[model samples]
Target: MQKIDYREWGVDTLFYWKLLIGLGIIVALGGLSALYMEHEGHWVTGMTNLVVWGTPHMFAVFLVVAASGALNIASIGSVFGKKEYKPLARLSGLLAITLLVGGLLVLVLDLGRPDRLLVALFNNNFKSIFAWNIYLYSGFMVIVAAYLFTMMERKANFISRPVGILAFTWRLILTTGTGSIFGFMVSRQAFDSAILAPMFIVMSFAYGLAIYLLVLMFTFAQDNRVIGDNLIKRLKNLLGLFILGMLFFTAVYHLTKLYGTKYHGVEYFFLVDGGIYTLTFWLGHILVGMLLPLALMFCPRFSPSRMALAIACGLVVIGGLATMYTIIIGGQVYQLEMFPGMTVINEGYGTEVAKYAKYCPTVPEFLLGIGGMGVALLATTIGIRVLKFLPETLADESVS
Candidate 1:
């Protein structure tokens, strides 16, 4: 067997360097936004007592889920024994770390007291899912890094399969944990479901692949490298399949909710009458996010065009965000059913059972979320330039 030659991106063009610098500035802006929010407190943002987790959580969770999903390429090679995907493993591992770091950073910085991160880490509660997530997230970093080492270090290659399997299993548990965070919320009519664990897993597949394809395309385009049509076709087909799975879960989720007479009101609120929430769910997630992307990728005319694939990938990402917004923010906006039938009101929340709270995201919150993306991109950009993360070429002849 011939060993694959790993090479740095080695992009020395002025344009390449400028792009990295520009992304760095964006990261800096995001940091400044975080500082402002921390100084003024959570009150400065759109978050209120009623809607505690807002836009930042949406973005953070997306990045986190996508991060694990991004490992599909590596998992395909190591766990599933797909030889074609083996070359992409290093970049896959790299993305998992950087994207998760970006996500966890946004989540951590959103804390009213960002300084208390150590306390959050040290003060562990085994009963709390969030506490388990902290360990999962931290452990993921260590284990995945070791997994990457098994790929990077030739002598350690013997352990790659075992480490890969471990990493793959760990991410499943991590994503399931993340999903249960919402699924376990029995008080909220929107969340309480056993289906969410597998649903999130499927979602991670679509969102992760979309982001991976985006990054793969962009990076390859940047270096003027050729990606094999065969490989990309497989990726696009996989993406389409995962998306269909997402739609299946989305449908089943609503169908299951619609089945219960009590859940009808909650379903109506999100599906028909929640105004922006309804539009976002139907138009943004279902129409633009799912349908349009599927059309772009599967359509005979445009499917062959790389640009069409890119657009589909971009739309999928937008849809993923829209879905999260509906799930996280919109879910919170609707009042939790403390008393199922009675219209209970409290001093803390002066509203009826069906009343929805208003929460508009502030600029700082947006930047903070974007900064997490910056952190991910910045890490990837720097890592590729410095290390042998990218293959010299992915042309069928070269890779084969």
Candidate 2:
């Protein structure tokens, strides 16, 4: 085997420096915001008892789920003998590890006692969905990181087939664990279904692809590397399929809820009725997020430039965020008592019943949530610069 050297592909001096500086600024601002939130308290954010969790949790989960799916490229290529996917293997693995760390950070910051994170490991709640997620996510991160490091070492002759298999298996379990966090809540009509688990798995694919395309485009732009048009076209086609699957699952899930007359009916009404959340579900999740982007991606005549792909990726990412919000926020929007038979007969189901609860994050909460994203971006940028993470060329010898 020939030894591959990365320096052959000349470094992008201007691009790398600018990205590093921008990342530093984001990290500094985010750090300051976090400090302010810590001193002032959770009251600064919009979160209330009704909405105990907010956008930060949603984005954090989104990042982890997306990260797992990104790891699939490497797992599939290594385990399933998929040669076409080899091009994305290294980058996908890197993104998976980086994003998971970022997600974990945001989740910890959201905790009431950020310092009590270790307690999650000791205080085992066998029945709690969140507890299981804590364990699975931590383990999965370790496994993926190990796999990535092994691949990075070109001197290693025998790839650990068992390690690859373990990674692939764990990702599936990890995704399911993530979904069960929502699905196991039988009290919450919005999430009490087996469909949510698979829905999350599919959502992972959508979000992962969106992130991959965005990152790939940026890398290509900076490095002036041309990924063959055929490859780009194939990727777009696959993305289109995933988007369609997501849309299909969404429709079926909601339709089943509406068709059945029970607590689910009331849950459906919360979305269909003229409520603020209904607007978010219909406008943000469906129309703008899924339908429009699907239309663009599926249409052949539409020019698939870097800009177009970026916009589509952005929409899909937003859509994934909205899905989590709809599941978590929309589930709590309507009180449990509001269900048809459960409502008190004396109340006669007045406006109060239909009003549903409200929750908005405070400024400090917003700052923390935004700051988490800033931290993630900063880490990714810095990692690329300091660690020589991103290859200067698609076929750069260093990657091999």
Candidate 3:
């Protein structure tokens, strides 16, 4: 293997700007949705007193967690000293930051008081893990930017590895903090476990890599760059491993819930008869997200084509979102047991005892959530244009 030559994706065409503008407009519409929600109050949105988080949380958390995973390619090159992955490192860093920014924007926009975001920073609650996440999220962005600089600048070559190492470690902590946001919730039976932190960590790897591969395939194929089959094969194997890991953790989580006799009802709600939760977990997350992608990855019949790799990547991403929906929204849909072993009377939560709560996000919520994705895509398009983040070619000989 040779030292990979990194180069800008020098596609200077009017169509490129049109694409960026188009994405920006979508993000703008999302902004309008957020404003409408704020004006009419959450009464206009799908978020209720019980299901306060809504679809925005699912989208935001997915993007944020995926952001950490997106940096893995860069880490493989910079930290693990893998020459084959080096050419992809810069774009990895750029995607990580952009995806994170996009996710965070959705989160902030969905807040009850977006203007008081500064209050969250200054007027802090030291006891609240949610508050601490504010810093951890910001810190992640800063560290990643620095990490990107170290990669881009020849003057910083001496410290790139160290910076990469730091960014890698920082993102782990960031994702842990994110997962803890739910794990620390004592009131929710679905969330009160130490397992969530590691679950998110592992899920991040799969989600992040899935997004990375999709972006890589598109950019290279669009510009007619030589993305070697060898590199695609290696990344595909890693993606499969992460997808399988997500499945394992999900099983363990539900199984643990089932182990607790008190949580039998909850287990049944999620695992057996929870309707949408069950469908998402079994059909979307497991069958579509995990199994099908794994089949695509390992089956020799599909191994040689980049198109196959792209299809596998798309399935993994879908699975990632499905997994998020089940975990975040499904967990909430299964009502919290106000009193165990006793039928709750006069609960005033719009639900009788042992009954799950129903929530469906409105049009505004959907637009806002999708808008976050648009932001990440738009930022990536712009970043690649101005920066030498992509390599000109990845011919098997050059990258192997």
Question: Which candidate number has the best lDDT?
Answer: 1
Candidate 2 accuracy as TM-score: 0.88
Task: Report the lDDT tens digits of candidate 3 across residue range 84-110.
Answer: 888888889988999999899999999
- Backbone clash total, candidate 3: 0
Model 3 / residue 2 / CA error / Å: 3.1
Task: Kindly list the per-residue Cα lDDT of model 2 for residues 170-202, writing each as its tens digit.
Answer: 988988988888888788777788888888888
Residue pairs clashing, model 2: 45-362, 46-360, 46-361, 46-362
Instruction: Please write out the lDDT profile of model 1 over residues 258-307, one tens digit for every residue.
Output: 99998887899899989889988999889978999999998999999999
lDDT of each: 0.89, 0.71, 0.86
lDDT of 3: 0.86
Candidate 2, which segments miss by more than 4 Å at Cα?
Answer: 1-14, 338-354, 388-392, 395-400
